[model samples]
Target: MEAPRLTTKTFHLQHGTSVYELHLKRLEADRVQLRGTKISNPEGSKALDEVEAHVQQRGNEIVLKTANGPHRAIAVRTARGVWVSLGERTAFFEFARKDVDAVSTQPVKTEIHAPMTGKIVDVRVKPNQKVGLGDILVIMEAMKMEFKLEAPMEALIESVGCEKGQLVDLGQLLVQLKTLDNKKA
Candidate 1:
């Protein structure tokens, strides 16, 4: 007989400027448990009590049962990360393995893609616009939650492929960019 698999997955998630560390483990058939800690919170103190939840996915929605209550959420997997919407809060987390430095290991890219299949709520820039790192370039809404797509680095907007109220698919190209030093491109 084979021993039951015991696999734990670790993830680093970024919401706005806050980072969270989460560990997920299977607790039983069709059920999983998640334990998380906030690594940083921009509004105040950094310390947070560990959070625990029992999660299960049903179709495109995820149901998380916590000490508070049951909450429904939506999660979409993208090329570089995952887009998650819980209650009225939505976040696109830049995915990284435990062995990798999430910030330092990212390679510069010139395209901004839709992190989830949602409607574009707003577009903040146009062609030739110069944006700094962490600038909000677009806003999207999915499953009743709004998500802000921010600039990963300083760049010049080369093109805008989306507009206000436009529906976008996951991984769809929404904007093209030219790095600050290579703006001519």
Candidate 2:
């Protein structure tokens, strides 16, 4: 996790039922330290390992130092969490530490919205079709630029809301997806 400015803070990061306490401290500019411990270890259970890492920001890029090595990454402070990019992999972490407290608008979302004002050039998937990550589900064109919105995660296509030549506005619902858990519901 990273921010444009520096400060000392504590946070609770949660993904599913796992909650972790994250403490951030800056010893100096370009040197930020991290300490993490799980906050929900049950009695008589094996303890969750405590983790420590360092973050060094250089201009627009960041270097994450762990026991492994210094790895290059980009960390962007988002509305609800930090968006960290390590090469082709990216992850979003949710927290409301210190002055930033943005609740995630969707708890269990499966809908895909229009990323921008665009004309739907094609709708590729039908209901019940299974798609994996990075699979393109829709093709859009806006301002003469083409965009392929892909599956954010692996799921079954529940429905499609647009068709060829359909014009959609920003945030318009374009497709609905359902994972295995939702199917069991």
Candidate 3:
């Protein structure tokens, strides 16, 4: 048996519609540094910072000591992607390619995007379905908690962007709806 080798890797972390480019490398025994740059800010104003951290592995739990404080997390890697849980919250991430994801620069008012990364447990409405404000449109699961996302206003669902069991990123569009009064030709 030999000590595990550490190398540098970069990733694009998607939080909602925002994508962050992160560089990770191990510096010393159980110590590492993380640097991140925002790559999806259409505003063109991006600032990246570096953070020093220490990690302690205890069986299935890992504790990260950062400048802020010590936080515990659990990481699971599967064929689909990597799932990480911190406290009661969890986030899912996938590897990013050099080709940045193409996102619309226009502001969207009728689109409902995931507020956090999670698995789509269920979709309550279908395309063209009429829904009132407060109607639950989708249910997602993260860190053993289920969240029901509702309609912000009465609208007819123009399209559904997510299916059951789909992994969605934060700010990733899940549903597009139009006000009932906005009739399309």
Q: Could you say which candidate leads in lDDT?
A: 3
Query: Candidate 1 versus the native: TM-score?
Result: 0.46
Return the lDDT, model 1, position 134.
Answer: 89
The TM-score between candidate 2 and the true structure equals 0.44
> For model 1, which pairs clash?
none
Candidate with maximal TM-score: 3
Q: Which digits, one per residue and each the tens of the lDDT, describe model 1 over residues 1-185?
A: 45446577878766555566777776554456676665443243243555566777877698888789999999998887888898899888976555334533344778999999999999999999999998999999999999999988999999999999999999999988888897344
RMSD (CA, angstroms), candidate 1? 8.6
Which pairs clash inside model 2?
Answer: none
Runs in model 2 with CA error above 4 Å?
1-108
Task: Estimate candidate 2's RMSD in Å.
Answer: 8.8
lDDT of 3 by residue, 77-162 (tens): 66645678998888887655545545324233688999899999999999989999999999999888999999989989999999
Residues 1-185, model 2: lDDT tens digits: 55546577777665443455677766555666676555432321123444445776876578877787788998887677677789788776676343222222223568999999989998899999999988999999999999999998888999999998999999999999998566457
TM-score of each: 0.46, 0.44, 0.50
Off by over 4 Å in 1: 1-5, 41-48, 97-185
What's model 3's lDDT at 3?
A: 62
Scored against the true structure, residue 114 in model 3 reaches a CA lDDT of: 97
lDDT score at residue 153, model 3, on the 0-100 scale: 92
Per-residue error for 178 in candidate 3, Å, reads 15
Model 3: clashing residue pairs? Answer: 16-170, 16-171
Specify the poorest-scoring 10-residue window by lDDT in model 2.
Answer: 98-107
